[model samples]
Target: MLSEKMIEQLNEQIKYELFSGHYYISMAAYCASKDLEGFANFFIIQEQEERFHAMKFFHYINEQGGDVKIIGLDQPKTDFKSLEEVFDLAWRHEQFVTKRIHKLMDFAIEERDHATQSFLKWYIDEQVEEESTMLSLLRKIQLVGGKGHGILMLDGELAKRQFTPPAA
Candidate 1:
């Protein structure tokens, strides 16, 4: 069973995850509006991942015999001035989520909640990959300066991205 404090923290993280879904979907719409189909596809996949992340928390909380508290999320931005701005926001958001996951891991360790710690290990590794991917993409965007044929080439590459559901 999870402690009340642990449950509270986990619920907060769930809210954050849900908010990430909202944020990414809105970004996806913005990309679509700009006719950046590949970028739109990328953000849409990100949106789905965030939903999966939130559901993971929901299932875990219930499995732990905790009452899942559904929290409200703030509105997400729907407009972007440029592709660079969209990607910059993504980079910043991923960094923020990485910090939140690290904080949760620290709390789980302090509480000696081995089950929670073990569960969070998946998320820890996920966050590492998430940040790495975002940083690598940001670097590529920087190299291209969000202009000319380079952006189109990158878009073509991102267009092929499809979300493979996690293994059962």
Candidate 2:
């Protein structure tokens, strides 16, 4: 069973993950409104992935015999000036999540919750991939200046992205 502090932190992370979904949902709307269907597809997939992450944490809490505390969802930014701004926001959000994950890992270490720490190793590895993908996409957006046919070409590229469900 998870200790009180560990349970609290895990619950908090669930909230963050849900908010992360909302963040992507908002970006998806912005992308759709801009007529960037491929970019929109990317964030729509990201939104699904974030909710999946939240559910993973939720199930982990239950699996660990802890009470799941469902919390309110905070608002996310609904507008952006350009595709570059959208990807920049995504990159920054991923960085923020990485920092939060580190803090949670540090707490789990301090508390000596071996099970929790072990579970969080997945998140640690996931964060690396998340940050890397966002940064790489952001750099590409910057390189192309997100204008004219460049973004359109990127749209075609991003359209090919598919969400591979994580292993059960």
Candidate 3:
């Protein structure tokens, strides 16, 4: 059974994951407005991935005999100055999430909850991938001077991205 504190933290993480999905949706809207359909598709895929992540926590909490709480999320930023700005924000968001996950891992270790620690290892690895992906995209945008034909090519590449949920 999960301690109350652990349960509370897990519930909060669920909220954060859902908020990430919402934020990605806002980014997608911004991309679509700029006629960057590929970029929009990429964000949409990211949103789906966030939702999947939230569900994983939800299921894990339930399996561990913890109450799953549905909580409110703050509104996400909807405006973007440019594609580069959007990617920069995404990379920063991923870093924020990585810190949160590490904090959770620290708590689990402090509590000596081995099962929770083991479960969180997957999320830790996932955050690494998330951060790398966002940073890579940001770098690519910068390399292309953030405009023109290169941007279109990048968009096309992003459009081909599809969400494939990892094995649990």
Candidate 4:
């Protein structure tokens, strides 16, 4: 059974994940408005991934005999002046998520919840990949600049992105 403190923290994390999904969807809308179809597609996939992440936590909490609480999500920004800005925000958000995951891991360790700790190990590793991927995209965006041809090339590259849901 999860302690009340752990359940509270996990609920907060779930809200954050839900917010991430909303944020990505907002980004997708912004991309679509800007006529960057590929970029929009990327964020649409990201939104789905974020939803999956939240569901994983939801199911895990229930599996551990903890209460699963639904929380309201904050609105995400839907406007971006440039692709660089969009990608920069994404990279920063991933870094933020990494820190959040680390905090959860620390909490689990402090409570000596071995099962929670073991479960969180996957998230810790996943956050690393998440941050790395966003950072890589940011670097590529920096290289491309905000010019038309550059943006087109980046869009083409983004079009190749495919979402593969994480294994159960």
RMSD of each: 1.2, 1.0, 0.6, 1.1
Estimate, for each residue in 43-68, the C-alpha lDDT of model 1 and write its tens digit.
89988888899899999999999999
- Over 1-168, each residue of candidate 4 has an lDDT whose tens digit, in order, gives 899999999999999999998998988989899888999999999988899889999999999999999998897987688778888898899889989999999999999999989988988888888888878877887886666687888888888888898875
lDDT of each: 0.89, 0.90, 0.97, 0.89
CA deviation > 4 Å runs, candidate 3: none
Backbone clashes for every candidate come to 0, 0, 0, 0
The candidate that achieves the highest TM-score relative to the unseen native structure: 3
Worst 10 residues of 2 by lDDT: 159-168
Task: Spell out the clash pairs found in candidate 1.
Answer: none
Error of 2 at 96 (Å): 0.7
What TM-score does each of the candidates earn?
Answer: 0.95, 0.96, 0.99, 0.95
| Alpha-carbon deviation at 106 in model 3, angstroms | 0.3
For model 1, the stretches where C-alpha displacement exceeds 4 angstroms are none
For candidate 3, write residues 1-168 as lDDT tens digits: 899999999999999999999999999999999999999999999999999999999999999999999999999998799999999999999999999999999999999999999999999999999999999999999999999999999999999999999888
TM-score of 1: 0.95
Lowest summed lDDT window (length 10), candidate 3: 159-168
